[model samples]
Target: MPNSSEHPCRITIGDDGPLLVEGPVEVTCADGTVAVSDRFVVALCMCRRSRMYPWCDTSHRRRTQPGEKSRRDTG
Candidate 1:
C-alpha cells in the first residue's frame, strides 16, 4: 500500500556493500516473496550470504585485514 508523497524514496549504492534504502521499505524477492522493514533506513543485502535473506545481517563483511575482527557468522 502506498500513499501520495511529496518526496520520492531515495536509494544509494556503494562500491562494495549492500544497498542503502530509505526508511520503511518493501522488497520483492525473485521467488515472489515480500520482505518488509520499518526502520528509518535499511541495508538490503547485495551479497547472497545474509542469513536474513533480503535484509542485511552484516554477513557481507567477511573481508577483514590482519589483526582486524571479522563480522562474518561465527555461530
Candidate 2:
C-alpha cells in the first residue's frame, strides 16, 4: 500500500547499478530540455554512461573499459 501524504515517488538503490525510482518522472536538463516517463518504475543511471539520459539501460553492469573489471551483482 502507498501512503497518501507523500507524492507518488520512491527511489531504490541498486546493488551494482542504477537508482530505481517509481514514477511518472520528469527530468529537465541544464539546457532546458525535458524528458518525461510514465513508467511504473524508472531506472536512473548512476554511472553516467547510459545511452538514454535520465534512464538506466544496464550500462553500469558492464566494464568501465576494456580489461577493466565488471560489477558484481549482489542482489
Off by over 4 Å in 2: 1-3, 6-8, 64-75
The lDDT values for all models are 0.82, 0.76
lDDT of 1 by residue, 1-75 (tens): 233476667779998779998878879999999988888789998998999989888888657677677665365
Worst 10 residues of 1 by lDDT: 1-10
lDDT of 2 by residue, 1-75 (tens): 242555645779867788888777888866898999888888888888889977887887645565567555335
What TM-score fits each model? 0.71, 0.68
Query: TM-score for model 2?
Result: 0.68
What pairs collide in candidate 1?
none
> Quick one: best lDDT, which candidate?
1
Each model's number of backbone clashes? 0, 0
State, as a TM-score between 0 and 1, how close model 1 is to the true structure.
0.71
lDDT at residue 9 of model 1 (Cα atoms): 78
